[model samples]
Target: MNEPLIEKTSGWRGTRELWIQAAYGALLETGIDAVKVMPLAERMGLSRTSFYGHFSDRKDLLDALIQLWQSKNTGNLIRRTEAYAETITEAILNVFDLWLLPDLFDSRLEFAVRNWAHSDARLAAMLEEADIIRVEALQSMFERFGYDTVHASVRANTVYQTQIGYISMKKDGPSDPLAPRLERMRTYAEIFAGQPVTDAEAARFFARHPVNET
Candidate 1:
């Protein structure tokens, strides 16, 4: 059985966000090839003409997608990492929260963009630049925690590369359940932070970022 396309909101005449979101969702679920205007229009149950009102063309949409990735992933992450933390471990834990929490950062979107980059040289270059920005932010966090420049850089690379590797490697299995997976992530975070997050701290974080199972 096939699901029906989602209809547009009634009397909706606004900015380009809905269309952009549709494109992003398509890119995540399918690939760059699925990001064409007609398919997205079909999914949104909107006329093809509506997309033109928001974007000049497909290239415009792609450009918007790139901008969205930069602002959402890199910009938001740097801000989160730079937020107040009493210790280096806490600071790193703050950053780890973004990875663990889906609402903060979309790992599937990141993977989709990386897959898109494999075929486009210019996109690949842009992705590389974004990666540098992200790693530099993490390095700055380590430096703020009193690490020497060299060691901070190395630690930053370690954390960032571990995540990149995880996304890059494709696995097929009946995965371990969420609780165990999250526990393992906590262990990984503790290793990176050089100490376990206290129960109170972990509780506070969970309160703020309750997992969305829906």
Candidate 2:
């Protein structure tokens, strides 16, 4: 039947996407140590050469995957931040929330990437650049909220450090504890900014706009 044929075609497309998704998932679930080229090919039900058609080699694949993640996360952050750029406190909290989203930690890709960075200078440089981008984004939001340059930079770093600490704790301890910690973070931000958190505040902080043209 036509329906059966259509289903089969859709299945192939699904399979390819699944393979790509699995590659990232594997990296997150288990570090690069688990990423054997032959095994991944077999898992995808394809020959090793087929993978080469998609990527030149393992390193190539890794680079592509990192770029994909960076693009996705950066876009999401930019869109969300632009949507809500009103007050300093709201903007800071929005940044924190995006960084601490539950799905962000559900994978081991960050850990795997950190390990990869040790030997791969290129990867290390990319990670550093990503950090700078993130910090700058936060700083810009702070400036929109009326903070001076020095204070904005300092507060952004503080918030960033706190999020990193939370991630470290989630890895070392019970991740289920993150929600309460996030709440505490909000409380801390409120105290520091001397204002109550509000939905309008969050909305203004998350409002989207174009990146400034140089």
Candidate 3:
């Protein structure tokens, strides 16, 4: 019979990243309530004592989760949106690419964090801060493309809100395949930018930043 793989821990018996990853998995699979130390330790085939070695308490673990969401989702989006873009339309598309690609930003984690935000006031505040950062990144992108402050702000909110709505809404059945969905979102990009994105430009963008499935 094959033996179950054992998870090796470093000096302190386990690393902080191990606990954080297990907690993240629980948060995404079940919910925030499932992220308790005992449950996570049990899942890892370890005792609760080792959890305290990494996190101070349950609240500390929760805070770490929030911080992870802020850095992974918000920080990454800001970097991608603020990168090179010859036009506002391409900039909008760049931001959209983050949402479409799970490797860039994990949508499951995003939905989980949003759900957690509803039950915790402190986390809700962090969620709001992340939203502001994303909007400001979009606005800055528009400004760089020569849009005035007023127009940039409006366009930023428009693009950001549409994505928020998509995440918040309930869906049934299988989602549209990637190619068609990207095509539809390309139309949204044009509308949000108040400009047209030619087929050649869109193709170039996709070719340069091909979506990785593995």
Best by TM-score: 3
Candidate 2 accuracy as TM-score: 0.73
- Worst 10-residue lDDT window for candidate 1 reads 170-179
Q: lDDT per prediction?
A: 0.79, 0.60, 0.79
Return whichever of 2 and 3 wins on TM-score.
3
The CA lDDT at 45 in model 1 is 72
Backbone clashes per model, in order? 0, 13, 0
* lDDT digits (tens) for residues 28-57 of candidate 2: 767666566676765555556666666667
* Candidate 1 residue spans exceeding 4 A from truth: 1-4, 8-15, 170-176, 195-200, 206-214
The pairs that clash in candidate 1 are none
lDDT of 3 by residue, 1-214 (tens): 3221246555445778888888898898899999987778778766678887888888998888888888878888999888787777777777877776666777778889999989989888888988998899888888898899999999999988877777777321025356666667778888898789988769976775565477
Superposition TM-score, candidate 3 onto the true structure = 0.88
Tens digits of lDDT, candidate 1, 134-154: 999999999998889998898
Give the 10-residue window scoring lowest on summed lDDT in candidate 2: 1-10
For model 2, what is the alpha-carbon lDDT of residue 5? 16
Q: Arrange candidates, best lDDT first.
A: 3, 1, 2
